[model samples]
Target chain A: MVVKVYGPDYGSTKGVLLCLIEKEVEFETVHVDGFKGEHKQPEYLKMQPFGLFPVVQDGDYVLYESRAILRYFAEKYKNQGTDLLGKTVEDRGLVEQWLDVEAHNFTPPIYSLVKIYFASVLEGVPADPKAIKENEEKIEKYLDIYEKRLSQTKYLAGDFFSLADLNHLPFTSYLMNEMEKGFMVRERKHVSAWWDDISSRPSWKKVLQDYKNPYDVLKEMNLVN
Target chain B: MVVKVYGPDYGSTKGVLLCLIEKEVEFETVHVDGFKGEHKQPEYLKMQPFGLFPVVQDGDYVLYESRAILRYFAEKYKNQGTDLLGKTVEDRGLVEQWLDVEAHNFTPPIYSLVKIYFASVLEGVPADPKAIKENEEKIEKYLDIYEKRLSQTKYLAGDFFSLADLNHLPFTSYLMNEMEKGFMVRERKHVSAWWDDISSRPSWKKVLQDYKNPYDVLKEMNLVN
Candidate 1:
């Protein structure tokens, strides 16, 4: 049975979509429109108690948390399309370590920035300049660490592109393209190259081509003009 | 050779210590005093660029990120001591899912509370009541979800006690015992029980008996009254 993924077509859902495509796993998306509060509906909440995006149902097994879903498909189909988890135990350890780094360090600041920049646009409230500046500083400090690490290794985990690097896609895309913070990536030489390399991957390209971002969906629904 | 863990004996370092003990892996501590800015030194930055607590060195392989270290040792010693990563792919997926939840949803607010509550105690500054209240509400909301999940299963991932459950030890202990927020755990029946159950594990008991918290070290160093 093809896996059924329930969520909007953007954000973390796109991360999961990119992973599935890379792993050559067959899956279909069941959109739960967050703008409409459909994710908070009891039916959707059954799969994801927190009513978060991108819950995957593979046969009798169900899972949420996009990173975990990415790991699941990567591990389940290790040899098929992409070698995501890496080959050895040590490599896998580094991958897991950097994955946590992305979760704890990288995503938070970028997520805050996204909320400050984009959510303000949506909610019609003025963004707090102080909070935005603080978040940018945090991101710069973190990316400096990444810049150093990426100088040594081609990717965050190692030379191979693992889930650690892949995990940064959704929010970093917001940082780079949508939020007008591309300099955060472009200012650092190795990081800029790394972003270009990973973002241009065929899998990510295919995801971009197929799925509409959340804002686009809102425009289509006449929720935002 | 016994693994060498570099960091102080508290906070995230203790999480790795708990995992090592549970897995029956022999290890020694090399304290990097954060209060003294030792973690930010050039040599320590070589291992962990971000200068975070608890970087583990198992022979030549050095790894940081407390959760990742837990997963690493858990995988390496899977057949020896406690089985943490679960038995099958689906089980492992669930374990990874809850681990992410603990990292993303659970830890952030609790961490913020820790900094707000405990850091104030250390810095001799007045704790911000508004920020504390906000963090408390965030933690309470996340715990409500955990309460529902724990009501169904003995642990976060499943009936088996896995890393997902174990990862809650460090901060939750601070919240429960030290930070005077025991009511957060005590308020939720299932979550309170879950906390009691996980906290009573012999491995955690040993960690508490063996290690000193940062404040204790500060007092010993004549840095704090």
Candidate 2:
């Protein structure tokens, strides 16, 4: 049986879907519209207890967590193309390190930006300027590290465009295009160049097309910026 | 040359130290006393800019991040004993999944508990009662999951004890004994049993001894209940 991924079009899950598309791997997409409460239903909860998007099922094995799903797919379908985990033990460890950095260090600030700007505009809550500023400062510090790292290597993981780089595309793209008007990767030449390179990919274009405007759905609930 | 780990004796880095002990891998420890601001020093920051503990320098290869360090040691010292990453592709993926779960789901609640009751006290701030209550509730929810999983498998990765189980010990141990007043795992039969079994191992006992006054250190700060 082919692998099946259950998730929305855009959002963070788009990273995994984009990866699958990039590799041209055969899989089924089970759309669970987040705005419609389909993901919260009992049946879906069985697949993912957290009621989160991007749950992948391969035969009898089911797994959630977008990063894990991406890693699993890449390993399972190594023949599909690029090796995201890396070719050597040290390289793989470096890849894992950067992936963790993305999760622990990078994602928190991005989530803060989403919550303050996107969530408030959509959910009818007052966004805290202090929180947003704090998060931005954190993001800037990380961007400096990325800027330095990218200056040396073409991709986040050495020469190859591994999962480490691909995994970060969804959020960085959203930050640049939709989340905040002032957000710009162009300040960092290497990061900006890499962002443009990844964003221009055909698979990424498909992701942008699929992601529906969450703000529109929020408007229905009388939640507006 | 022996593996040299630069980290404080007790901190988040303890997880990597425990892994080294469990594998019976010989290594030298360099104390980066966090209280003295050692981690933030120029030399230490050069190795890990994040200023975190448990940075391992194995000869010429320098690596940070506790999970990555654990995996590297497991792979490099494969003959030390148990193959924590798994022998098969699916097994390794499952191990990665559980590790991700540890990073995302498990650690947050535990940290919440630590921050509310322990961190505030350690840093000499008043503990928030409401935050403690909320964290305890969250800890309970995750413990139920751990109980259920432990009931079926001897260890987190199955019959064989893997890195997944070892990776969790430091946080879970601190939560159960020092921070949560031993109430976190005591009520769950399977979890409690597993804790007793794992904690009693010679390797784990050595780890505990390495960190002096385990509870008293927190108690001195009035962080332990």
Candidate 3:
């Protein structure tokens, strides 16, 4: 059975779709437009109790949590060109390690920035400059680790392009856009180089082109440029 | 090779130890007393760049994240006892689901309480009543979901005792003591009942007995009594 993903365009769900594309796996995308509160609606919430976007249904199997979904897809579709999860026990552990870093260290600051600068506009809350500054500092501290690691390795998971790099594609994309407007990635040369490589991938390009702006309602609120 | 875990008697490391016990895995615990800043030492930092406790070294394999450690141990020691990760694809997905819920939903409020009520005393910061109350309300909202789920299933993974249930043990123990003082868990019937069952487990009992002082430290902070 084909996998069905419920997600918004240009969101974290885009990461999952990009993975599927890179794996060349056929799947169906069910766009749950966030502007309509579709994700929070009864149907979507029934599928994902937390009402988060990027819920995947593969046959009778249902899974959320983008990292887990990526891991699941990678393992299930191992015939795909890349063994992104890991080829060995140590590699798997390292992949898991980087994924944790992505979840615990990277995403928080990225989301913090998004919440203060972007989400406020999307959710109609006033943006807080103090929060944004705090978040920027936090992002810089976290990026230091990535910068150090990427300098030694070609990808997040050493020399190979693994799910760890793929998993971080969306956040890097968002971060790059933020950096162009004076965010800190450029100063972190290794991170900047890594981001440039992943952002330039064909799969990521497709994701960028295909993602629908579910938060367009925020435009009505003068949130997006 | 005997698995070696570098962890303190208290904190989230207790959950790791509990998982080891539940799996009937033979492991040696290297207690890094947090009071001395052992976790931040260069050697420990090499094992866990985050400077967090609960770093496991099984032979040449080393892993740091507590949840990831639990998954690794569960997968490696699958025949010892419980199938905590899950027996099937869907089961594993649900295991990941609850784990994420615990991490994303449950942990924030718990951490907030720890920061305001517990960590403040340890760090010599003044306790903020406003933050404590805010965190308490957040925990209450998230516990309602756990209440509903536990009312239906004997365990978090439905009918089987899984790592999901084991994962919550330490946090719940801390919360229960907190509830006894000012933090509230008694009002939620199902959550209270679920707590009673899991806390009564032998593995949890062993963890509580082993981490006596930190438990006292939590009580001294009035986070638990």
Candidate 4:
């Protein structure tokens, strides 16, 4: 049976969808509205106890958390597609290391800032400069580390463009292009090159072309009313 | 070759050490002091560019991030001892989902509170109440989900013990015993029972017996001047 995914096609679930596309896996998606509190509904909670989106139901098996879903596809479909998890134990360890870094260190600040920035853009409220400055500083320090790492290795885990690199695409893309924080990645030469290289991939571009912002996501579902 | 782990035996490295012991794997420890800014020095940075401890070296491969280290050891020594990842693809997906929960959702608030609480205990200044309250609230919400899950399944991932449960031990132990947040876990019936079951495990007991706090780690290294 094809995997059934419940979440917006272009929001938090975008990464999972991108992974499925990258792996060329067959999956069906049901858009769950985030703006209208649909994700918090009891039914959604039954599928995902945390009431978070992008939960994948593979026949009887269900899994939530976007990155975990990515790992699932990468591992389950290892013989097919990109082989995102890496080959050797060393490569796998390094891959897991960067995936951890991406999850713990990289995404938090960027995601926090993006949430506020997106809401501000939608609701027409000025973002807290103090908060923005703090989060940006956090991101700057991380990007510096990324700059150093990318200078040494072509991708985060190593020469291979693995899930560690692909895991970053959606969030970082939104941060730079949507939130206008391009300088965060672009200013650092290695990071800039890394971003350009990864974002330009056919899979990510496909995600971009099919992607919708939160506002559209809400409106399309008639969730605003 | 046996893995060589460089980091404080306690502090953040405690998780990796516990995983190693749980796996019944032999490893040589070289404790690195964080207080003296040794982790920031050039030599340590060569192994871990992030300059964070517990970087584990298995022959030519070196990996850092405590959770990543846990994953590495679990995968590498699967045949040696307790299997930490999971048995099947479904189980693995669920495991990764919970691990992601530990990383992105569960740890952030508890870690933030721990840092503040630790600072308060070490220095003469008081911890920030508002900040603590905010973090505690975040944790409380997550524990409600944990309580629900524990009611359904014996452990976070499932009935079987995996790294999902072990990954939680270190910070949570500090939060409950050290920071007097037992109520956070103990107040919730299922979560409390779950905590009790996991914390009393022989592996965790060994971790507690062998672990040292950062202050002790510094002193042992003669890093405090």
Query: What TM-score goes with each of the models?
Result: 0.94, 0.92, 0.89, 0.91
Pull out the clashing pairs in model 4.
none
lDDT of 4 by residue, B1-225 (tens): 888989877756888878888999888888787767889999998888777778988888778988778877888788888998889877888888998899878988988987885576556468899999999998999999889899999998898999999989988987887668899898899999888898998988987877686645545556453
- Candidate 2 TM-score on chain B: 0.90
The digit string of per-residue lDDT tens for model 3 on A7-105 reads 877667888898889888888888787767888888887787678878998877788887778877787777775678667656776777787778888
Question: How close to the true structure is residue B189 of candidate 3, measured as C-alpha lDDT?
Answer: 78
Candidate 1: regions farther than 4 A off? A218-225, B215-225
B1-225 in candidate 3: lDDT tens per residue? 888989887667888898989888888889887767998899888888778778999888788888878877887777786668777656776777788778777877776776565456566688888888888777777777677787888777677778888888777766777434324567777777777788898888887776654757557557654
Candidate number that wins on lDDT, 1 or 4: 1
Q: How high a TM-score does candidate 3 get?
A: 0.89
Fnat of each candidate: 0.88, 0.43, 0.30, 0.79
Tens-place lDDT digits, model 1, residues A1-225: 999988988888998998998889899999888878999999988889888888999999999999899999999898999899999889999999999898888888888877675576667779999999999999999999989898999998899999998888988988888678999899999999999999999999888889988667657766566
Proportion of true inter-chain contacts also present in candidate 1: 0.88
Kindly list the per-residue Cα lDDT of model 2 for residues A96-207, writing each as its tens digit: 7888888889878887787677656656688888888888888888888888889989888788878888888877865776665334588889888888877787877886
Chain B TM, every candidate: 0.95, 0.90, 0.90, 0.91
Q: What TM-score quantifies how close candidate 1 is to the native fold? A: 0.94
